[model samples]
Target chain A: MAEDALRILVIDDNRIRASVIEQGLLEAGYSHVTVITDIEALMRCVVEIDPDMIFIDLGNPNRDSLEAAFAVSKAARRPIAMFVDRSDAAAMSAAIDAGVSAYIVDGLRKERVKPILDLAIARFNAFFRLQRELEETRSALAERKIIEKAKGILMQSKGISEQEAYDLLRKQAMRQNRKLAEIAEGLVLAAGLLE
Target chain B: MTGLRHQTQIALGFVPLLDASPLIVAQAKGFALKEGLDLRLLREMSWAALRDRISIGHIDAAHMPAPLPIATTLGLGSLPVELETPIGLATGGNAITVSEELWRHMRDAGAPEVAGDPIACGQALKRVLEACQKQPARPLVFGVVHPFSSHNYELRHWLSAGSIEPDRDVQITILPPPFMVDALEAGRIDGYCVGEPWNSLARKHGSGRIVTTKNRLWPGIIEKVLAMRSGAVDADVTRRLITAITRAAEWCDDVNHREELADLLSQQDYMALPPPCLMPGLTGELMLGDAPPSLEPDFLRFGGSATVPLPSQALWLYAQMLRWQQTSFSPQDAERAAAVYRPNLWCEATGLALPQPFSITTFDDVHFDPGQIQTWLAQYAACVE
Candidate 1:
C-alpha cells in the first residue's frame, strides 16, 4: 500500500489525546486516518474500517480486545502484528514509554509506518506533557485559594495586614523548609480545628 | 547492616484478581521484607499491558498466566520475549460462566441445575447450541481473558469434549476480567471463562451463572505463575524471591488467613472489589444463582505442590496450543515450551528434591502423558472428532 493510502486507526479513550493524534496524522498528509474514542465499539469499527495500521494508547484497557482481534479476526485480509522493529530497539522502547503502540497488517514495510509511528510518539509525548501541566496548574490554583484563605485567617486572628499575613506564612514555610502551600494547608487545618 | 543482606527492590506487575494474592500478601504481610527483598506490586489494567511492561524490562517480574511464557517463547502471538517461571503462584481460580438466559437453555437441554459437573454441562451447552443452529440467529459469543490463557484452552477443551466445535459452533472473544460481568449484562457476550471475583461478581449480580470451574475442568491445573525475564535477577535474589513468595502462598492457603487475604486483595491497588467478591474463589464456596452455595475445596489452590512449576503442565498447555492451532508442533518447540517452567529453579531455591513428573488428569478420561504428547494428541484428536 502507498504511504498516504495506508488507512490508519487510532484508539485512545482520551478524546483530546485522540484528536491530537488524529490532527497530527491528518496534517502529515495521511488521508485515511480514523480516530476512535469509544472503545466499546472497537470490534465493529475495526471490521468496518479494515485499516492497515492501528494506534492504541498503552493506558487503554481495551488493548486486550485488539490483541484478541489479532488472534481471531477472520475478516482482515492480512493478519495484524504488534509493531516491533527489531533492528531499532530504541524506537520501540521510546514508543512504549511514550504510551503508544502501533499494530499493522502483517508484511507492511517498516519504512511506510516509521513516520506515522514517530509522529504518534511525538504527539503522545506532547499530550502527556500537556496533561501534566494541566494537573500542576490545577493544584497550583487550589493552593492559591488555600493560601488566600490562610491569609484571611491570619489577618483576622493576629490583627495583621494581608501582606503581613502572607509574609508570616512565607517566613514560617522557610523556617520549616517546606512548600508555601504546606504552610497554608497547616494554617487552614489549625483554623478549622479551632473553630 | 551495610553488608549484612541489603533489600533488593523488585517491581512485579500483576492484574488485579484473586490469584494475585500471593504477591500482594508478600508485600503487605512482610513476607518479602523478611527475605531481604522489597517487592513493589504494580497493578496493570490488562494482560497485554502487563506482558508489554514485563517484556520491555519496565517491570522486573510479573504474575503471569501460565501459557503466556510458552506462547511468547514459541513466538505464537507477539514478539518473543523469553520468560521463565521459577514458581507457580496459583492454580484454579477460573470458571466458565454463562448468562442466566444461557444457563436456562442449558438446563432445559438437561444440564445439572448446580455447577461442578464439566462434561454434563458441556454436553447440555452443545445441545442448546444445536437448538440455536436451526434458528437464523448469531452464534453464541464467549469471552476469555486472553488468547493464550488456560481459560481459553479449558473452555475450548470443555466444548470440544462435548462435541462442540469451538471456532465454528461458537465464537470466542477476549475481555478483561473486570468487563466480563458488564459484557454479560449488556448481552454483548453469552458467556465467559475468566478468573475469580469476576465470576463470583457475575453470580452475585444475577447476570451470569457459574457452569464449570477450573478444578473440575482440569484438576490441579496450573493457571498463574511468578514469571520473570530470563536472567533478570541473580541466583541469590531469585532464591530469596522464591522463598518469600512460597511463604506467602502458604499463608494464603491457610483457612484462617482467608478473610485477611480477601481484605488485602480488596484494597484499591489490588482487586478493589468487596471482600465478599473474593471469598468464593478464595474459599471455594461458589454460589450458582439463588441455589445453595456449592463447596469446592480445591477451587483455587496456592499451597503445597500447587506452587511448583510443573514442566509437564507446561507441555500440556503447549499441546493445547497445538490442538487449537495457535502454533504447530515441533520437537524443539515442545522442548522450549517445557523449559519455560523451571522446576529445577524451584528445587534449588527451596532445597527440596525435584518432584517426580506427574501426568495431568482432566475431566475427560484421556491420558495426558507429557512423554507421549503426540500419541495423546492423536488419541485426543480422535476422541474429539
Candidate 2:
C-alpha cells in the first residue's frame, strides 16, 4: 500500500500532542498531513484539505466539540480514526454511528498510529461499501417493483398475459438499447401521462 | 492482592480531580483488589464525555457529576442512555475562582479580601460589571464543566442571589476542567466554577483568586456520585464495588491518609498535577491566590454517609434540571429520576449506617425541600426576575 500517498488531518488543540500523532504519520512516510489546533475552523479545514482520512487526538473532548467533529466526518464521508484519552459507552457508540473506523481509547503510542490508521481506513471502506451495497439493493428492489407495476399496466391495457407484457417491455428495452428499468420507467411515465 | 475470589471485571471512569481520590486510593491502596474485583479506572477529562461514555457502556460506571445520572436516564442530552447512581462518591469538592484582574476589580468594588460570603463577592462583581458596561471590553465569561453540574447550579444560585444575571450580565461557557486554569491564565475567561486543585492550581499559578467554595455556597450539596448503566451492574458486583469504595473513601478521609492520597494522585497515570495542589483541598486550609491559608475545615469531604446515594439529592438535581428547562416538571418523572439514587441499595451494600436522605440548606436562607421541589423552584424563578 502507498501509505505516503494519503493526505490526512490531525485535530488537537495542543501542538505538542498533535505532534505525537503527526510524528508517527511522518515516520510512516505520510508527509501530506495537516495538524489543525483550532476546532472552530475544523469543518472549514475538512472542506479545504479534502483529505483521504482524519485523525482526531483529543486528550479530553466535550460532547459539543465531539458532535461538531462527528458532523464534519459524516459530511466528508472520509474514513476517520479518533484517539480519545477516556471514553464512556455513549462516545464509542456515537463514534461507530458516525462511521468512525478506529475509535481507540487511551493507548495511542507513536509506533501504533500507522496500523490504527490502516485499520480505520479498512473499517471505513468496509462500512462505506456496505452502505453503498445496501443503497444499491434498495434501488434495485424499487426498480424491480416499478417494472412489475409497468408490466401489470401493460397486461391490463393491451389485454396481454403477464409474460407477454414483460416480453414486450424486454423487446422494447433491447430495440432501444436502453436499460430495462429506463424503458419500464418510460412506459410508466407515458401511462401516467395518457391517463 | 490475593485471597479473595472475584466474578467480574468492572471498568470505572473518573475525571482527574481531587474528588477522584477515593477511587484512586482504592486501586493504589489495595482496597479494590481485596474485594476480588478487577477495577480499571478510565480517567476522563469532561463531564459530558464521561456521561456519554458511561451511557454507551464503553465504561461500566463512572465517578459522575451528581445530576448526570438523572439527566442521562431521562435521555435529556444528545444521546439517551439510561443511567443510575448506586452511591454518592464525594461532596464539597468545588470552588469558584476569578482571574487576578477580575479579583482585583471585585476587591476595588469592595468585595472582601478572602472568602467573603459568595453573595458579597457576587455583588462586587455586579458593580464591576456595571462599570464595564460602558466600554464592554468583553462580557465577563465564566466557565462550568457541564450544564448539568452542581457547579453550574451552585454558581447560578450564588450569582443570582446578588442579582447577577448568569447569561446577560456574564457569559457561562463550558470547558473541560483542565483547560479552565489555562484559559484564565491566558485571559480568555475571567472566572470559573470548578472543583478543587483546579481552583487551588489556578490560585497557585497566580491566574485566579478563590472567591467561594462548595463549603460556603451550599454546604453538603452532594457533588459526585458513582453512576452505572441501569441494571448493567448486577447486585453482587454493586455490593463489592461499594464495599471497596467505602473502604477507600474512609481511608481517603483519614488525616493520616491525606499525604498518601496526595502521593497516589500525583502519579503520572492519575491527576499528574503536583501533590502540593492536592494538599489544600485535602487538608482544608486553602490559599486563595496570594491570600493566606484560610482554614475551611470541611473544604472537601471524602468519606462516610457522604458516599450514600440520597433520593432527596436526586430530587434536588431534578428541580435544577426543571429550572434550566432541560426537563419539564412532572410528578411521576420526578419520582422516576429520584429513584436513580438507590438508598435501599446503600443500606443493603453497607448493611449499616444508612443516613436518611435530607434536604440542602444554602447560606442565603434558601432551603431545598425535595418534597416541595416544584413549589420551591417556582418561588426561585420569581426571585430571579
Candidate 3:
C-alpha cells in the first residue's frame, strides 16, 4: 500500500487545527497533504483529490458535522484517523463501526501524528485482510457447492456413480489445463440451460 | 439539599438540534447543579458518533435518537455496547423539508393547504416523482440523517404510502442533519427529513421549505432520548442524572420558559441558531416557506412524563427495523428491544408512574402491537420496499 507520493487529506474546520495536522504530516516528509475546511462539497472534493489517507480534526463536533466526516469513511475504503476535542463512548464506538482506524480523543500533539497514522494504516490493513479472507472462504465454499451439484448432474446424465463423475470432471479439467471451478461453472451453466 | 453521593463532573453529548435543548437546559439552567452534578455538554454532529462516544466511555451519556439505543442493543449497525436511556429528552421535533424548487413542484402538483398533512404531501410527492421520470437520470434525491433513524423510517413510510419507492422512484441518501441545509442549497439532494432546528435552519438559509413535520406522520412515538452506556455510571449517579434531566424537561415544557428556552438554545454554545429558528420548534409557531406561520403550540414536548421511554415505542422501532431488514426478530427480542427504555429506572429515579404508549396515526393502515412484533412486521412488510 505504498504510494509513489503519499496523498493525505486533512479534514478540519478550524484553521489552526488544520495547520497543526498539516504541519505534522509535512514535517514527517509527507508532501502531498491537502487541508480542506469547506464542507459544502466534501464528497466532490474527495472524488477530486482521492487521498491515500484521511485525518479528521473537529473542534467540537455536532451530529451533522460528524456524519459528514463519517460518511467519508463509509463511502471510501481509505484508512481514517479521527480526532475529537472530547467525545462520548457511543461516538467512539460509532467511529470504530464506521471503520475508522483510530478514534483519538483529546490528543493533537505534532510528534504523535506519524505514529497514529502508521498505527491506523496497520489496523486497517489487518482488519481488511481478515475481511478479504472471510469473503474468499465464503466464495470458495460456494464454488465447492456448485462443483458438487455439477458432479451430481454429470452422474445422472451418465450411467455412473458420483465417484466416477468426479473423476471424469477432474480428468477433463487436467486435460484442458483450466481451473476446476471454471470448468465446473461451465458444466453447471450447461446443465441449467439443458433443463 | 441533595448532594452528590459519588461523582461531580459528568460529561454528556448532544447534537446541535432543537430537541438537544433538554441537555443544554439541564446543564445551563441549574437542574444539574441542583441535582449535585457538574455537567459538560459535548456537541456532536453525528448520532453514530454520539452513540460511539457514549458507548466507549468517551462521554458518560448523550442526547440520542430514540431508536438508537434499541438498534445498538440489537447490534443493528454500530458496536453492540449495552446502551440504554434513563430519560427521554424531547419528542416531536423532526420535520421533512424540501428544496424551494422541489417545494414549488410539490405545491403545483396539489399539495395540501394544511402543511402538516402527511397524506397530502405524499400525494403531491408522488405527482412530482412521476414528472421526474421523464428525466429519469436525475431522480429527485432525498436525504435522511441515518439509516437507522426515525427520519429514514418516516420518510420511507411517507414515500411508500404515496406509492413512491425509495431508492427506486427517488434516491434517498444519508447526510448528517447539519449538512442537510448545505446539501439542499448545493442541489445535492432535493429534500431531507431531519430534526429541528434543521428544517427551521433550512428555511433560514433559504435552502428548503418545511413541507411537513413527523408529528403529522407519526404522532405517538417520542423522537429522542438521554442515552447512557449500560453500567457506565454508578446506580446513584444514574438516578441523580435522570432526576436532573427530568426536572430540566419540566422546565423546558413550561410556557413561561419557552422564551428563556429559546434564548438559551439560541446561544452560540448550544444550537448557534437564531432565536426565531429555535422558537418555531420550541413554541410551535412554525414558519413554512411562503406559507403563513402556523401555530403548532406543542410542536415539541420538551417537558412532561414524555421523557419516560414507553416500551411500546421500542416495539414499534423494532418492527420498523424488521420491515427494513435491519434486524431479525426472535420472540424474546421484543423484550430485549423494549428493555432499552429504562422506565423501571426512570420510575426508580423519579418516583413517577410508567407512561403508556401515546396514540398515533400512520400514513398506512398498519397498526403496531409491541408484543406481536412478528405479526406487525408481516403486515408492515407490504408497505415497505
Question: Whose TM-score is greatest here?
Answer: 1
Model 2 chain B weakest lDDT span, ten residues long: B1-10
Write the residue-wise lDDT of candidate 1 on B1-385 in tens digits: 5632687899999888888888899899998998889888887787777777777787888988999988877777787878899899998989889999999999999988776688888889989988997885989999998899998999999999899999788999888889889999999999999988888888888898998888888888899998888987787888888898899999999999999998888888887788988888899989763367878868998977888998998999999999898988899999999999988768987889988876687898777999888887897677654
**Docking category for candidate 1?**
medium
Model 3: residues >4 Å from true position, as ranges? A1-9, A14-41, A44-53, A58-114, A117-195, B1-7, B204-207, B288-290, B330-335, B357-361, B383-385
**Compared with the true structure, what per-residue lDDT tens digits does model 3 show for residues A7-104?**
67767666655666576667766778787787656666766776655655333333343343443344434332343323333443444543442432
Which digits, one per residue and each the tens of the lDDT, describe model 3 over residues B136-237? Answer: 658788988777788989998888778887757887777777778888999989999988878887887777888878767787478888888888788888
User: TM-scores of the models, in the given order?
Assistant: 0.92, 0.72, 0.73
Best by lDDT: 1
DockQ (0 to 1) for model 2: 0.13
DockQ per candidate: 0.53, 0.13, 0.13
Assess each prediction's global lDDT (C-alpha) against the native.
0.86, 0.76, 0.73
Interface RMSD per candidate? 2.1, 6.3, 6.1
Alpha-carbon DockQ of candidate 1: 0.53
- Give the per-residue lDDT digits (tens) of candidate 2, residues A35-61: 888875776776677665565532336
- Deviation in Å, model 2, residue B317 alpha carbon: 1.0
